[model samples]
Target chain A: MAVPATRHDHPPSRRAAESARRAAGRSLRLGFLLACAIFFGLPVTWLLLAATKTQTSIFSDHPLSVGSFGNIAQGWSNLLTFNDGELVGWIWNSLYYAGSSVVIAVFLSVPAGYALAKYDFAGRKALLVLTLIGMIIPTAALVLPLYLQMNALGLLGTPASVILPLAFYPFAVYLCYVYCTTSLPDSLLEAARVDGASEATLFFRIVLPLSKPVIGMIFFFSFVHAWTNFFLPFVMLSDDRTFNLQVGLMMLLQSTDAINAEGGFSALPIHQPEAALAALVAVAPVLVAFVFAQRYLTASDVSGAEKG
Target chain B: MTDTETAGRRPARADRQGRRPASGAESTVEPPSKRRRRLAPYFFVAPYALFLVGFGIAPALYGLYTSLFTDSLGAGTEFAPLGNWGEVLTDYRLVDSARNVATYVALWLPSMLMLIFAIALVLHARPGRFAAAMRFVYYIPGAITGSAAALLWLFMVSPQVSPFSPLLDLLGVENATEAVSANTPLILALMGIAIHAGGWILIVYAALAALPRDVLEAAVIDGASSWQVAMRVKLPMVSRYAALILIATFAAGTQVFVEPTVLATGVPGQISSTWSINQLAYYYATQQGDFGKAAALSLALLLVGLVVALLVIYRTKFYRIDRGLS
Candidate 1:
């Protein structure tokens, strides 16, 4: 009777200790995540708040304290007041460039990726090798060369110079290639081919329909790339009228004493609040896209892409 | 629609090809279909090929050619082989910038990878609304990039105005310039991680989610702890994703440009204008107006990136065409 009682008591105590350990681990994980959240969340929160404060208040007040919505409107008006509302033009140019480039990038990437994945052809390996090189070659390395080529072609300072190089998006192609190889099965393609479907018909009817997820992924990334691309456009376009928000914002902050109090003596009302507001405006579209496309960003059968 | 139409269509196609159809049903349609199939890949690849050659390869080759010649305002372009290359290679500024980039990458890559994997694995451990919310919170900063990111981070490092005031004060940073000048690499690494880590975390988590449920269940049933399952079972399985992340981040980190450039602009004189290797290349082009030196430096950077890329590609069998898939 004593032995049986002791055994029963031992199991309960062990189980209680195990539950306590698990609970401690749970809280620790939660604590770490929340700390990360604060680290990631503070700067943007401060930016939004900063847009609502005056230049002096931006430095004086608590970092996350709210000032007023009217200050944001004031900041917006001040930003517009610069060079007769040039900020609006910059926004439009960003949309035009990114929109057109993304369309071209998606259309080119999907078919090329599908062909590479599904078909066996001569020079397939060579094409793969070149695409990998293009994918990894940093834009800084390519931007100057691309500039020289554009200068020789007399395409400098044109939208085409920025749009054309951007549309040659190797990363999007690689993403599609990986997606098609992993998620897209061969048996389905073979069945479609066995039917009276011609190659064009097969691509348009079957491959296109099945490629929607990758196409979405490609579109989002390429759009983000083109819209946020400062170096390429800065090198290519010298005209202030053609400047995207990224370059324009840099110019805005630099010309005004928004960040530093040393040298900027411009009469324009562009200050720290205005700069923060402009940053928010620049980020807003990408954030919207991220919210919508978050689901598509997930890798499907990504293990297949990794052979380990 | 019918088998007869399909069969007859093949014969017509073969005849149009100026070749006779074969004797039986099996062989009759093979010749034309085979040829059509052979032609299909090229057709699919043609447009991309045009862009690749026109934008990617041609510019690169032209850059190589440009690097061999020297240009001057008064004198016409001269074929001075390796003249610009020699100048750029011997420049002390190049060495300084190279060291800066190397330090930044060294600080950023390992920390970012560890955070990405840790957060991703933890999220995968108990995936629910909280995990989703964490991911959403993490990804918000990534949207603010390039110049916008520069603007945001400028304020972030300023002790007086930043939300991270206490942290900055503890680090003994007095002002924005001091924060940036004294700890540029550390600050940039933190900023890079904050901006880039979220996207990678989402990717790794997705990979984890797609893992076979049965294998994990088996491990659990065999009396494995969660820690054991994560380290022993899941980590090795997701090593490929880690490799992919490594190759990409390595290249991006080596070409660090916009952060330092915009930070320098904001602070005026604290950070050097040519603080990064890529910025030095740009300096050669824009400030000096010497395209030859610029081309030489950029090509050299590209070579460095390519060497790492080739090593990763070979190690991972990245370009290997699987026989079964083919």
Candidate 2:
């Protein structure tokens, strides 16, 4: 009777011990995660708060406190009217460059990917290898050559300088290729062909409709890359009028001392709060886009790119 | 009605012909009409090929040619063979830039890896609705160009007007100048970059998620804890992804231009003009007009990029998988 009772007791004791261990592990993980979150989150959180603070209060007050709501509007006004509206122009240039590049990149990459996956042809292997090599080479290393090429073509200081180079996003092509090869099967293409569809008809009518998610992913990736790019535009464009947001921000940082010396309210443009507000403005579009498309941008895409 | 009937007739013919080997029927149905179809692949690839040859291959070759000679920026071209390479190899600024790059890689790579891996593990172990949201938030900075992100960090770290003034005060920093002084700016800049580039970590996290669940389940069943399974089982399996990340991060980190450029304004004499190879090249090209040396420096960076790329290709078996051609 004692042995039976002890055996029953043994199970509960083991169960209790396992639960305790799990709870401890869970708490430890959560603590580590929370700490990391705060560490990374603090700077961004500070930026959000600073955007609402007036320039004087930004320096004197508690750093994390939200300022009067009025400061947010004031900051927006300062950012807009700064240097006769150069900030707004810079933002528009960024959108133009990134948006056009994304559109062109998708058009080229999707068709190329579809062709590579569905068509059996000679030199396919070499083309795929070229795509991989293109993806691996750093964009920084290519900037000089690209600059010289643009200069030779008399396209320097033009938006074409940024837009044209960005259009050749090999990574997107590779991603589309992998997505098509895996998610799409050869049998479907064969079926479409058997139904008397021409190659163009098959691609447009069949493949592209099924490829919306991957297309969105590629657009987002390319758009973000082009938008955030600095080195290329800095090298290519000489005029501030043609500058994108990244280049414009650099110009602002460089000229902050001059602005401070001017002393008038209009001349003393782009103080600390305004700078933070501009940075927020710069990243806002990308943040909004990411939020909307967060579901499709999964790890599977990353792994699939590698494995495929 | 005619279009549907024509389409319906084609499939029936295809079905009948597919069952039997009909060389005659195959020609009539699918028409090997022109050799253009045979050459279409190369035609599709020509523009990119031209780009590779013109921009990539030619300039790389030209850079090598220029690096071997010495020429002044303003003066007409004159060749002093292998002189610039020798001088650059021994120049203090070049040496310092190399050291800075090395220090940056050492500090940046490990921190980036650790933060990314830790966050990924946490994300994987307990995925919630907020996990995706957090990933998107972190990645947003990456989409902001390097200059903009650097500019954002400048505001956040400036002691005088930083919203994180209290945090900086805790660290004993008094002003923006002191916060971005020479001794500490590189470290601060690196930390900012690591945080800003955190979105790439999602790539590694995705790789982790795609690991066969059975392998992890086996480890768990065999009395392994989550940490142990992550460390011993998962980490080793995903070593390829880690290596890929390291190589890429190392390459990108070496090309540090904008961070140093923006930060240099705050600390002028401390960070020299030619602080990085890219900056040095820019100086030679635009400021000094020494296109030869600039070309040489660009070539040197290109070589480094190639070696790094080749290392990735060799180790990761990047293009080893056989798709079709045996």
Interface RMSD of each: 6.3, 6.7
Q: Taking the tens digit of each residue's C-alpha lDDT, what string does model 2 give over B1-326?
A: 33224323322234334533321243444454224345555555566555545555555555666667677558656677767776666667888888877777677767777888878877777666767756765665455444445545666667766656677888898766667663453544455454545655665555555554544655655556678988987777666556556655666677666667655644444466777777777777778766666776766675686578667767765434323211
| Candidate 2 Cα errors over 4 Å, as ranges | A1-10, A110-144, A173-216, A235-241, A256-268, A298-308, B1-69, B73-75, B79-81, B143-151, B155-176, B182-189, B192-196, B206-243, B322-326
What C-alpha lDDT values do all the predictions have? 0.78, 0.64
Clashing pairs in 2: A228-B145, B73-B289
- Which residue pairs clash within candidate 1? none
Q: Tens digits of per-residue lDDT for model 1 on A142-177?
A: 777788789999999998998988899987777667
Model 1 misplaced regions, further than 4 Å:
A1-21, A151-157, A185-213, A297-308, B1-37, B73-75, B206-240, B323-326
Of candidate 1 chain A, the 10-residue stretch with the lowest lDDT total is A299-308
Per-residue lDDT tens digits for candidate 2, residues A244-277, read 9988976775566322333233354567677777
For all candidates in order, state the fraction of native interface contacts they contain.
0.48, 0.20
The CAPRI class of candidate 2 is acceptable
* lDDT for A110 (candidate 2): 76
Fill in the DockQ of model 1: 0.35
